[model samples]
Target: MDDTLTSTLELAADWADRFAELTTDERRQLALWLEESPENAAAFARMRRLMSDTALIDAFDKGDAPVQPLAPLPELRAGSSRPARADRRKPMLGRRQAIAAGLAGALALPFAGYWLAGGQTAGSPPPLRFASRVGERRRFTLPDGSGLLLDAASRVAVDFSEGRRHVLLEQGAARFDVRHDPARPFKVRTPHAGMVALGTSFSVDHLAEASELRVFSGRVRLDVADQETRVVPADRWALVHGATVSTGSFDPTTHPDWQSDWLDADAMPLGFAVQRLARYSAAPVRIADPKLASLTFSGRFRLDNPRQSLELIGALFGLRLEKRKDALYLA
Candidate 1:
């Protein structure tokens, strides 16, 4: 093999072993590398298939297989037949190849409340669920190169089957930077809305009474019950409440800053802003004056210090803050 092919295969093997464990930045690097060339994507796919093959996993489990280095994978071209096997002699697996295979096999074992009741087939991996508590955030990448940034008080379920990537946003908010695959559409399903993206970066915020979809780049098709599909383009958003779909503009810079550990409000209602801050607050925030709830305020507050945030809000809005045993009241 040439130097380029050898390097590509090595990188593929490395990713196969540590894909699930990669940080958000590391996953972004891998995604950019994959987008650099069609050949890279194909090579990575081949490496993943070899690593996940059940026959190799079974052989590894039995521990009686011949100890030989793995043969170099044949170079494949689009629409061309796979090269025939070199010979019947089994080659020993390389260290990286061995590690990838071992990891794949180990992942097949049941995880706590992650796997379905029945065992999953060898070809299909079990669904993985992720969640973040109040004031906490999480970031991870899916198998298909898509990345997710889950905000505070959020939960998501990810499933990648043969031809689709499905994600269920149970609550709170998440941002998705999706990898484009025409063969498989990335779909995010929320309680009040569903979004389908061919390739896009977007955010979904699901609250108790409504859901919001924001498109930062590319286009998204939003569907609400019995309503016409709303196609939202870049720098736009839609709010879905019951069966109503309301579209609006969103400036990326002025958007909520929860991902950056800040709550940003641009002339947002005081009640709504307080509710948003409550997600990161240690104590409940109450508005003693009902008339003060609709007062609009614009500002950015740090999520790490809820008390300070409340203080800033009080100073800005000229409201009085009262500390109680059960809650912080602002009148």
Candidate 2:
């Protein structure tokens, strides 16, 4: 480094202390000088670097000598030339004025800027979370190949590590099309139950008062509590609540009609088909009475035209329809 550059570094070692001793006018004059030349900015950056480097050395020094405070000093541009004597001779500012000026320059502007930006207060927005709303369904693929289907009004969070994938279903329902990976098991958590899988397709539902799980393929081990460890086989279903687990053979057709968008109720009750059919229609569709709700019929009905399907359902049940405010109320 040039001799003037080396001298500037030496002065910078006590720059803050020297700055404290200068008069207000001298500090103002130095500010003006810095503003006058691009060289002044470069010199300021170098001086700051020099101060940081010196601080590290000072920290390692043997004596607990109070660090001789750094003082403000004249600027030096990088050159074969030395600093002009006139710049060096400019008088220094005193402690109180220097503190005030430093506070205004270093503290107030940042404080004002943050306040104006509306972020100067105590908190940041709560961390981002994920959820699905009522009557809505959603799908998400994890960083792993495993897929998750969220049922109506559900919330779940995903956390994965090198050894396993875990999901916490805070509420509602979902289905999992778990990818095959023996080293890592896919696990789901609910208030009522826990599901651990070894590569499977399954659905889990948690309503306000009930929870159920259905396995379409492969196997899943459900642990309800210490007294129960139910291993659900392929094509099976289970209803769980508190410490109880009730397992049974899966009805594969239970979800196919809704998934396929074709209402095929084979000898299913007339009121039952009507209730199922109501989901796809915009209009309010219901059986006229509880007695009518149980009447049975079976056939494939087009999901597209709920009116025609309802008419079919009504004729089969010996009921008639009345339209009120865009809804078909059965009688």
lDDT of each: 0.71, 0.57
Q: Per-residue alpha-carbon lDDT of model 1 for 1-331, expressed as tens digits?
A: 3455555555566566567777876666677767776656765665564554334555666774443333444433333333333454335665556656444334333322322224234455545566776787877667788888888777787777668889999877899999999898999999898999957999998876678888989999998989888789999888786767778786787665676777777665687667667777767888888788778788788878877887889888787778898999886
Candidate 1 local distance difference test against the native: 0.71
Deviation in angstroms for 144 in model 2?
0.4
- Lowest lDDT 10-mer window, candidate 1? 108-117
Native-referenced Cα lDDT, model 2:
0.57
Tell me the deviation in Å of residue 59 in model 1: 32
Model 1 CA lDDT for position 41? 77
What TM-score quantifies how close candidate 1 is to the native fold?
Answer: 0.59
Clashing pairs in 1: 68-91, 68-92, 68-93, 69-91, 69-92, 69-93, 70-92
